[model samples]
Target chain A: MLDRMKQMQAALDRLPHLRRMGALFSETVLIKVDGQEFYLVFEKGRIAQLLEGPSKKTPYRFSFVTDEDAFEEFWTATPKPGFHDIFAMVKIGRAEIMGDILLLVKNLRFLKEVLALPRARREVVE
Target chain B: MTIEQITGRYLTVEVAGRAQRIYFEEAGQGRPVLCLHTAGSDTRQWRHILNDPAITAENRIIAFDMPWHGKSLPPEGFMQEEYLLSTKAYMETVLAVIGGLELNRPVLAGVSMGGRIALQLAVHHPESFAGFLAIEASDFQPAWYDIDWFHRPDAHGGEMGAALVSTNISPYAPDTERANTLWMFMQSGPGVFRGDLSFYTQDDSLVGQLHRIDTAKTPVHFIVGAYDFTCTPEDARRTAEQVEGATLSVMDEVGHFPMSEYPEAFRPFFVDGLARMPSAGAGAS
Candidate 1:
């Protein structure tokens, strides 16, 4: 699963527009799948590092926490309505969003595309 | 060189004593189908259906941008106050357009907030429109909006708005098509989409009033996509449960911005919905 997450960095680099859009964005995102925590550090619009966690020292700008089943379904090629998006999962009570909303909204385009990279194929809507 | 049968025109009308110059486009010549766009978006959402001969051959399609939306500039006051949409104002604008265009009992078709307004139109002006076709509309959705998320200074309205609504699109859509839908959000003015949400998520909630929709006087039909998480199929079902005699058809593999996200998938559902309309002329053309 982490290997797929690793692919997001290279994938985003291929799209110049998205890369340019988030050229200055650099932050760490916490992804809590079930009880486990994974920290992804992004630099210049790309994922520079992926760190697994049980530690408490590192800080995260935003967190996308979901259970195992929801995470698996969300990463599918074509997810069902409630499982299709982070917002959708949030709507259905399958996920929780915490931290600086402004940061997330500001970097949403770059972040959303990167998070959704685990899908089998990507046709960047734009 | 191809000349599509679409053309635009503007009309100045009085709403709440404010002179609003409404921009509208038209195509084909037959029974009128007044197309109302979703919240935040302009008449461009109807571009595909407006030019499709399958639709134009049978019905005259008319779409207009709401005041403070798209090309319809805000009335006076330059920039002194905030923009918020109310049910009364929305309905009045629609009625004003209907009156100005001299459209006699046209079928009222709206999506999202426009969809919610269909219930208002059916209840308030039962005798005015021939029928109601609501796409992705439901009675009410509680806590569906957060203004600060996109309307704040730190956040980019265009980027946030585009990315936020991007969740409403079906993943089955190609990157290019989904990008086009995102383009609409990217073009939205500051606080415009959030302001429109004021009506959809607040002011015009048809919670208990949906049952008042006079379907016998004018048929009310809802055609929703399966992938619209915001106004989900369940939401449409609950709305239909409230309104007596109102019909609903949930299409599979489609989402909120059906027309733009995947018009080919949306075309059949739209055609079938139109057929059920009272003004549906002489069967399918």
Candidate 2:
């Protein structure tokens, strides 16, 4: 999952203008998975800083769990899930979303497209 | 039902007096991402992207069958309407499905015909979508009507005036896979073809509407296939240029179906675009 996150971050870094024009341009994005979470700050589209400590001051935050089995089902299926089901969980309190709602919505399409990338898959152990 | 169960089940919703069942697979948990399919195809086109690691790692995703395609059955009287009405009906059905599922302001990602639907929704129902991802879409070029071939009689003529609506799915599939692929289209029958052609011909001077979209509240990103013959990359670029704050990315060596043809390249472009969106609580001005 961390590797996938890095790969995604790296992909974003490649787009210079996207970083410059981002809504939280210089702020750190605090991401939580399972019980662990970390903050990674991006400036000018590149990772400018990283913070591992628990800090509640970050301006942006998002969190989600990666269930390997569920992830596999999504990938292998022919007609996969749409935006409705994904967010329905959050709306119903089955899923948790932290931080700014408007910013999340603003970048909603961007987040969907990012998740659509193949490299976003979780690592499977044999 | 659990998130997994809700997403896993092949759910049905009534739209335009017809019950359409849509199949879906979901991951993560956050704002919904509605995936719309292209002409002659169903939700299956988004399979690769839906399961992409980048997507699952961050947000939840859903891809569904359009009316009369995939596991869903065509509505009664499906063939009675023009393409524009058909599209409008399908869009309404999609909205109903979303509402039935109980989601709010989903992000829309559509390809080809689906992309066109996304643009229309953005213009007509701006509040329903958080943003949109359009691949190989167009606002309908003015010269589209100038071509004399479209007005001629026969299937090819229908191709020009209306979008390419053919029950002959054989032409679209690899020769080895033609027989199996054609079955879906064959079942859809002539009504699907007629409705699709009508959608292709509807007046789509969306440029004026594009100017009216609230870009500050709803951002759009367009991904164009460099060699896409259906909706020229230039048209996608032009649309992007017109929408304030909209972003455009031209995928080289690719055609209209980037998600299917090159998932690796396509995934990153889309993922990066998402990461660029303003995080929630950024507030709308």
Candidate 3:
């Protein structure tokens, strides 16, 4: 799982459009995979830090909470309902988003593309 | 709930001065509804609606295959060439069917390419339809996704476009449903998919035309699937907001083909939209 997250981070780093869209985003986004947590600190549309574990020193502005299984399904090359997308999962009560609406909506596409990185990687591997 | 029995028939209709044999299906017996299919898809997309006992009990549900689509054969002398669907010809065909059938101000429900035409039909002939229900439609595609690669022949000289679309179906869809969707995609004739895209992505531009929509005359409702990347919920909402009295709803856990992708899951939203239509008959509304 950690390796997969790392791969996703690497994919996000290489997405050119994310870099352009990320210009509007600058915050620490938290992703809770089951009980574990990670922080993706964005700096000038780039993932400055993919910090593993929680930080008593730093705070996350937004967070997504989902189980490891749901997260895996979401990142799979092809996903089914209850896993196809963040919004889809939210509708089926599998995932939750906790954060400012303005921030999320402002960078919705960027965040969606970033989260979809693993799918792109999976496709390439297939 | 009991499933309604669906009956299909082929009617000879005059379209663009040509006598065309069109295939159509219907169920239930109430206010009439003319359902249209998505691009490269046939009446099968509305199987759920056509078979829903609740909808059928209260509404006359009808679905038809466009010329050059499904069981409908291409026009004479054009069978050897690629089937190209132009907006003008598409609309003319639809209008001809309505007139030939003498459907009285029936409610119009459509998806993708069908949805775009519903909007056009409403604008040009508002009094013709009681209400419009459009899914996966917008004024225009904001950007062309470069669909040329879809038509490129594979190693076996077969177009891979349909295969590409088959993959986009939500992974969570029922195995049988997914298989059916792939079957529909595979059944399409060569260049038919691209021909439909030409209208979906290019010829049909509803931009600056939303103002012409009179909700008082014909209420328009837009429903977009949550997982539809081609037409996002945000885009549908934005487009719906422009027209007065037009409502927008997002179907969750659904993708590009909501009704066919997950019929049971999609029926509630469909029913809800139908209920919102004032002209919908007593039991339906």
Q: Pick the candidate with the highest TM-score.
A: 1
First chain of model 3: TM-score?
A: 0.88
Error of 1 at B141 (Å): 1.2
| Poorly placed runs, candidate 1 (over 4 Å) | A122-126, B280-285
Interface RMSD of each: 1.2, 15.8, 11.6
Which residue ranges in model 2 land beyond 4 Å of their true spot? Answer: A1-126, B1-8, B77-87, B141-190, B205-207, B278-285
Between candidates 1 and 2, the one scoring higher on TM-score is: 1
lDDT of 3: 0.75
lDDT per residue as tens, model 1, A43-97: 8876778888876988999899898888778888888778888888998999988
Error of 2 at B38 (Å): 0.7
Q: For model 2, what is the error of residue B120's alpha carbon versus the real structure, in angstroms, after optimal superposition? A: 1.7
State the lDDT of candidate 2 residue by residue for B1-285, as single tens digits. 622222455777887776777666666666577777766556555666666655766667887776656666665665664333355676797788778777677778887777777887878887777788877777764332223333223333322222222111111223223333333333443345445545655646465777776777778889886545556567798877777888888876455566654565567777866665544334422
Q: Which residue pairs collide in model 1, if any?
A: A123-B175, A124-B175, A125-B175, A125-B179
Task: Write model 3 residue lDDT over B1-285, tens digit each, in one string.
Answer: 954498888878877677788888899887888999988778898887888887888899999999878888777877667666777788888777777777877889988788888888777777777889988877776432444433544311012444445433665566578667667866776667778887888774677778789988788999998677667677688778878889988877677788898786688889998887755542231
Q: What's the C-alpha lDDT at position B258 in model 3?
A: 83
The fnat score for candidate 1 comes to 0.97
If both were scored by DockQ, which would come out higher, candidate 1 or candidate 3? 1
